[model samples]
Target chain A: MRKLIVVLTLCVISSLALVAQGTPLPDSTSDSTAQLLQQAHALYERLDLERAVPLLERVLSPGWSFGMTKAQRVDAYAYLGASLALVGSADSAARYFRAALERDPFTDLDPRRFTPGQVAVFRTARRQTFAVGARQVSALRFDPRTEQLSFTVVTTHGATLRVEVRSVDATPGQVLFQGESDGLREIAWNGLMADGRLAPPGRYEVRVDGRSRLLSRSDSTRVYFDVRHELPALEDTLHELLLSELRPERYPPSAATGDLVKGLGIAAGAFVISGALADGDLGSRSSALPATVAATAALSGVVAFVWRRHHAEAPENVLANARRRQERRLTNDAIQRRNNARIAQTILVIAPASGVGP
Target chain B: MRPAFAHASGPLVLLALAAGAPTAAGQWTVQGTGVLSVMRHRVDAGYGVEPSSGVLAGPEVAASLRDRLTVRLWTRSGSFHADGPGAIDRDVAEAGLQVDVAALRWLTVQAGTTRRTYLTVLARQPWTTVALGAEAHLPFTETGVTGIVRGAILPGVSVNGLGHPDLAIAVASGMEYRRGRASAAVLYSLERYRFAPSATATVERREQLAGLVVSVGWSLKR
Candidate 1:
């Protein structure tokens, strides 16, 4: 009876072990968190901040760590806070931003990174100041997109104001508004040409009617108005507006590894099949299989070799030769000395203009 | 004049202009660089300079919309020669799209399509390739609907289908020991295609090409 009991106990233990082995392991929260993070990043890159914010919040709530060091974590927090601010939730954004600052008190953080949208808000909120004076009717230009213009007027006031927007290219000779206030009356010109169309792209001028009242004398106020086109480069523009926002550090290298492994497995299988035919089989079947394998392997090898050679050699040779030629023309020491001299010359030239009173 | 007010207001005005003007979103920049290429074909007999040898010029343009999505367009024009005739000039254009999902920290799914004209000895041929792909630093290539798992024993991979009834699958894995400027990679790719018999050909052929590729790329952009 005792022997029977011992056997039963052993059987029970074995069954428990089998059951434990058969049951799959629990899913990892880290992986789910990472996936969520990736989705959020994609949404953010697509400019769907409305979608990204919620996804990021979800991932963050899971108490996830992207295998980052403490310093990196601090940086991540700051970026997260800034990103939130960009999507229009200023309060939450500010909270995250503060948290990031708290984590790294010594770092000189640029608040502008979090306030792209805020700049517009602030500008609109600021009090609108329109200049007052009897300005001359010399030239006028206006840009409706920027809601600004340039004008010239003959006024006695040394108080004549010139507003120049460097980022906009306004249409030339356009009139916008005409109005009055106090002893200081104003004429607002909605910059439009006589043809009822926006003026040609150039500098514009507006003449205020009451310039003489402020100046207390009639002096020609020469307002040189220049307009510049403020357009972002294609690459930068695309990156800002459409490219996915991915923090390269948060990505795992495992995906790349897994792909390599899968390919290796396929290659190994082929190699094994070819080896089996060569070693065990005989007659036409064996010979044909081996031959087929050898031919496929050789063709693949050639194609791969050609592709790599083309990709590497062509680009490298061109770049290397050019670099060598450039190097031959100027040694490192000589280049450094030349740069230093140029720097000195610039400093000397700018010093007088800076009113240092040499 | 107060220096503080002058300096403070200058940047403030600039910032206002940058923020308020929609025109600030579009601009053109010129990037000039020289590229010299040398290529040797394994199937072809001899090599001196590669078939395509010369300076390459291209216009690269990118645009951003709504602050999250970006589109990039690039056009390259150059000349290459076949063994028979005078050098033939060719033009190639490519466009790419990147979608950033905020949930994934390091992975941005990328899709690109490209068109090229092959000017050869016999005739000029046009080929268009479409690629719907995603790249992650992981090892497995996900396809169809199985791309959701973060650690499903499969790494992320890209699959591209060519216009010539050929399907290409490639998987790559590597480690960058010294901050990615220098690294080694092992890449494996499989291409399967059915080659139809041409007018001069005697047989129809179905072919599969599979191989391992080892590569190293240095970062020269910086």
Candidate 2:
């Protein structure tokens, strides 16, 4: 009996799900709000206000059976407001128009597409709603020397507004526009940092903050972008020379003794060879011959020992090392100059990026 | 000088010119040196010994490339006066060409040829020889003082009126000092020749020459 009861409950739930799929539900997204707005626009063009009004109102309603982008939602509110205005519901039209204006202060009704009454209603909505917003950054690359990066910002009504371009690090950035601004205003930036240098490559934000002069309300909005530098590849400087690369500047202590020993050894060799190799029948060896070389060698030994002892430093090696260091410095300086010139030719590459904050 | 010496000297002059030719790489050095030597000459012919002495003086030119290879040509002429009453007086003239190749920092391998002529009232005699040798350098210091020892063996010897010597040897010990481009050296040199008894020459003959050689050099290129 329990199994039969559970089977009947499952059959009822399956039938309800099929019915829900066949008939659109308020909480189920069966169509995009953009598509619904398009349908309403077609209906309103045919003068079917009763059918278009319901469709556009459903798109703007909370928990409505559709999803939408910010632009699509704004389009739905605009169409609903225009339809109601033509039907003589002036208060309802004004309310829907203000909702679109609060979302995007640059929102407007085109006179070619809408009646004069609807355009007037949009203007009125703009005056009542207080909002500030920045347009998406366009992808562009321009040399900072001549061209500029442009940004579009708006205030719903005349207000004291400030627009700033800064890095994502929240560093003090350059203010492109300030003072009273109403509606849409184009701001230009020369791609320079606050310190009058070319803007370094990084993520940057374009922020617009305004306080309405008529109302005591304020609004702020920001858009993010990535800045890249389009420049020639820079060369790297050579590294410092190691100790092994340079010649020794001082002679070792053993050098003096070694010199002395070498001289003495030569003197002894001359005497030994003269005594051992000379023929006895040659009427005795000439003492003067061997004595001259021995004396010179022995004297050289003494002189070398004294000279090496007094002059411990090797001047030749020191001079060579200094010249090497100077050469390295000159090469590095040339590299730095080339790198600076390449940096001067930098072109800022700007592209829109997803923002992190309002 | 005998024509034989001029022929032996030809290849040495050519080699020196080749080594000294101007090149974009390596260092070249040409040094001209004045040589002064006092020589003692002795001859033994089984029965008696004849000793004589004389002074030999001449000029030598040396050309080196990169301090690694050197070529030298030298000539010295002098008269030897006999000490004994019956011995004959003779004039001696010698010329040599030599090449030295540095095989290591302190050692050099050498090959050379020498020609000697004895001019007497009775006859003119010529001798030609080829030798292989090595020299060892012992540097005293960075100031350019060096000690040198050299030894050579004559493998080919020819004499106008005598048989080949059973043994022929030459050796030298010296000291050299160089400052800037000027250099000076003093060396003790000895040469000996021994001939065994033969059918044509019944008596064993021996000859020896010993000398003190001093040189002053100036470098054309360093």
Candidate 3:
């Protein structure tokens, strides 16, 4: 029984040693690739290249079932390169470094965690490989007047770089920077379109393209984000005036004929009153008196008809309509002024997005 | 004469009211008009007809509220002489107070009181009448011109030393042209009365008056 207990203790101690040294354990359903990367990274920190390299390679293998984040995968490749460089395999180390750089041009070797030889191998890989990258946008809010939206981009080597923020549909966009760039660069945008108006809110892409001066290779990268406006509500201008609001500028065709009829009616009324109501005993109603009114009425009728026919335009109505239109224009202009003021206070709200672009 | 002067006080009271017209609630308009009138007068009371013509001048005041209610006061005075050799010569004075209430956009119902006094070389005759009427306004499209027609019946008429007439009516037709606050108007008017034969006078009495009136007016609004 004593010998069996001693053998059990030895087995437990050997397992603990193997786990700490990052020795490949039996692949289990619960063992995630990220957990394996952490173990390998820990071994690499302790300068255990022999165990760390094999564990990192196994995590990156095609047969690995566990899912790993992009950051975790990049970490695995970087650790493999560092471990291989420490073991004096310079060519293999450079190959892994190039792979990591291709996945992420912003990848770098921490001088505190890596030796000069490992860092030199990473730098040599960067010179040989061409890659461009932009950091994923973090959630932020800024006013265009006093602050700006910031983006971080990188080139693997000295290269001509162009960084632009554009809508996903390829509408004309603003170029943040276009010049020779080396290493890491922070580009800023003032939330304006190429036409100097506030950038409309929608899904946008921050595209970075680079052409390496040291090599014939070129690379491009895209990072998508959603832009939304945080602003005061804007007012709408007045619509066109309705017909009832405006006076008719021209008289209808019936108006002239109607006036003629009205005048004739007046003449007939006078004649009826003089001839029918007047008593003959009152010495025969003065024909001159009644005739005076009838003639005046009939003449007025003729004159009105001729005047209305020749003058089709109603000047009073034209003036009234013009005044109404001017009043409407003034009202709409006031509304537009208020809307522009509200838009000037707009705040750009930016957040990371996916599934937007090719 | 004292009673006739007292009867003329009705239009004076209306004129005072128009001068101090209330304008606190709705739109108010006040108009002042200068009137010139030409009249032909005749009378037949069991005798030969007497005919005469006269010219009169007067002032008229009107106050309107909300284009809905209106009050008017007017007075005219002149002398009539024989136009034919029928022996008619008298001095005439008349005053009236009228109120118009709009029943529709283009129609108004009116009530008024009129007092007319005739003075001959021997005596004075006074006639008091109450009238109910309707007026129609026809506006010419966009021309600032309006045609007016008015008819009224004298339901209550009283004259000293005379019986009430069996039939009495008045009618007028006119045209008005308005530009801004200034306006000019020309109107033809007629009044007729027929009285039944009475015990004191054996024959029916008939009287008629016809005239043309022209007025110019200025308006103020608040």
Chain B TM-score in each of the candidates: 0.39, 0.86, 0.89
Worst 10 residues of 1 chain A by lDDT: A347-356
Question: Relative to the true structure, how large is the alpha-carbon lDDT of every model?
Answer: 0.35, 0.82, 0.83
Question: Each model's TM-score, in the order given?
Answer: 0.22, 0.76, 0.80
TM-score of 1: 0.22
Winner on DockQ (1 vs 2) = 2
TM-score, structure 2 vs. true? 0.76
lDDT of 2 by residue, B108-139 (tens): 99999988887777788788999999999887
CAPRI-wise, candidate 1 is incorrect
Backbone clash tally (model 2): 0
lDDT of 3 by residue, B1-222 (tens): 333553564565455445445456447788878788888888887777888889876778888888899998888777788887756688888888899999987789999998988888767889999999999988877466777788999998888767778989999887778988788887788899888887655788888888887888877777
User: Predictions ranked by DockQ, top down?
Assistant: 2, 3, 1
Interface RMSD of each: 13.7, 1.6, 1.6
**lDDT at A177, model 3:** 93
Cα deviation of A85, candidate 1, in Å:
85
Q: Rank all candidate structures by their TM-score, best first, as comma-separated numbers.
A: 3, 2, 1
Clashes, model 3:
0
* DockQ score for candidate 2: 0.56
